[model samples]
Target: MAYDIPPDLAGMNLLEIAEQVQARKLPPVDTWKPESTSDSRMRIAADGTWYHDGSPVTRPAMVRAFASLLWRDPADGQHYLVTPHYRQTIEVEDAAFIATDMRDDDGALAFRLNTDELVIAGPDNPLRAEGDPDAPSIYLAVRHGCEAKLDRSTWMQLAEFALERGGDDLAVTSQGETFSLRPSA
Candidate 1:
């Protein structure tokens, strides 16, 4: 079946389209459902093209699809994915120093560490199943009212904080590897 394009996304970049998709600025048909289970599932074609259930996705529709997936929150409601190993408490915003090292619902080794550093992995990256024994593990830190910084210590501290809180609602997952963090309350 053919899908109609959203008027607003007639001309926009992938990022802009993604934003619009998240905002619900376009119709639902315009977005791509990456997690769809059937052959009729919509997807972005290999050539950077968009498709819905096996047909070409219109430019506007493709933009909306990319936008929705990119901007949509994976977290339960309050959490955001900084990376595979790092997630910050949304309620805390900036003051909360939080992180975690636990298996998600789908059973992937997940890590959440807060730091001012932008680096997420190092020579001995913890996220890796097995790598350099002496490699360093970098952390991604989010500072209050400031951009996130990269440092090893900061990530460790964030993880420690989240561990102390001890609650299940804070962590959730949609697909096997796609994990998200939410506040306990």
Candidate 2:
């Protein structure tokens, strides 16, 4: 079956994107308490590509559907696809999602993930800088204890946005929260 791909983020304004995000409803994986467990043999690469049985999943709809069921188990620090019936462990090399695009919405920061999901950075969903100070890997907290790593272009865009704010410290404020892009020493 053919699926209608979601509109490209570049064509939509922040408000429209935010509206879409708010309108969409996802499965309540958090509420699921499944007793059965198994290995999915699915792997999410560090670059945000999803692969099953060593084959890439190229369908946007399929990716989005699977992503909605994703959950990170705090006890084992492992990613899983949870359903009411069972929970299947999946491999994640880096982050589960990748922030492929970003835009400034008023004083806030908005991001578009590789799965075409929209996210706003704020108190509930915050930004964090990790890895080396010279080249940090910035991440945005997504739902269900998942995070989206800012891709190279998005990271550059964030740096430009931070520079526009003109602060000696490499920091940016969004939605009443301040995030330091420089990794903590």
Candidate 3:
């Protein structure tokens, strides 16, 4: 069988891509069962760039399409873009998407992802600080066991917001509750 690869999405802007993707309901990817195989060349870099055959996949539509097909296998602890017939392993250096923007929605923080998906930081959707203290990176649960890494600017904004709370350690508040972005000094 053959697969029709999506065309170049070089011209469509982010909003157009978001609209296109959001309008469609994702297929039931969780139910797909296929023989898992490692795909050495396809990867999702830490910066949220997708690559195939060792080249950057710059097409927005293609990325969105592939992202929709992503499924996390509990047995192997890896991510795959699954179909009824095939499951291809993808190297994800970090979280699949980046939180590009943040909004303080009435004391609750809302994160906007690179894919234009909005995730509200709360009890259910939580944020975690990872990596070294000198260079910490923030991650938030975006959806379906997938996390979105916060870009440097967004993390800085979150840190600043945390500082405004007047604490010895880094912390941010959402929905009248507080979450520590960094450990207490």
Candidate 4:
């Protein structure tokens, strides 16, 4: 089985392809249920670093190649790198990726992830917060169920976009809908 990039997305850089991906139909990865399984020895660190067998996979292209095969198993709620013939279980420390950069896109918050994939925060691709109130963990949905954790720098940058809504809520409007990041006094 050959895994090929879509002809429309072929030859395009990550940022250019990301915009297309926002509209393009994805291969039905959720429907692909392969029986073969193996340990990949690939781990994504909390900081969005990829390591293979304890060594860092420093090559961006190689990391992107593997990222293309990533899938989240709804049945088990685990992430895997899937192929037509096999599935490899990979460890994720926090999220599969990180939001390395952020900016305003139209009226939405657009994120450039470590994978170079850009995501415009909307109802389909929303941003949310978790963890401690003092040190919240921000996460952005990149695709179907794949999420990217926002690092402190990106989080701070996102805060600059926040507006006070309904008196004391720190909310950001994306695609016309306001999502609250936190409550403020």
3 against 4, candidate with superior TM-score: 4
TM-score of each: 0.19, 0.92, 0.76, 0.81
lDDT of 1: 0.30
lDDT of 3 by residue, 94-125 (tens): 98889877756457777667776666787877
Q: Which of 1 and 2 is the better model by lDDT?
A: 2
**lDDT (Cα, tens digit) per residue for candidate 2, span 1-185:** 22222357556776887798899899999999999999999999999999999999999899999999999988887999999999999999999999987877677888889887889899989999999998999999999899999999889889988887998999999888999999988
Better of 2 and 3 by lDDT: 2
Q: Relative to the true structure, how large is the alpha-carbon lDDT of every model?
A: 0.30, 0.90, 0.74, 0.75
Clash pairs, candidate 2, are none
Query: How far in Å is the alpha carbon of 45 misplaced in model 4?
Result: 0.3
In order of lDDT, best first, we have 2, 4, 3, 1
- Candidate order (TM-score): 2, 4, 3, 1
lDDT of 2 at 9: 58
What does candidate 1's lDDT look like per residue over 17-134, in tens digits? 3343246442232133334222224443323344445676567544433322222233443322132333322222221222332222222222322321111222222221112323
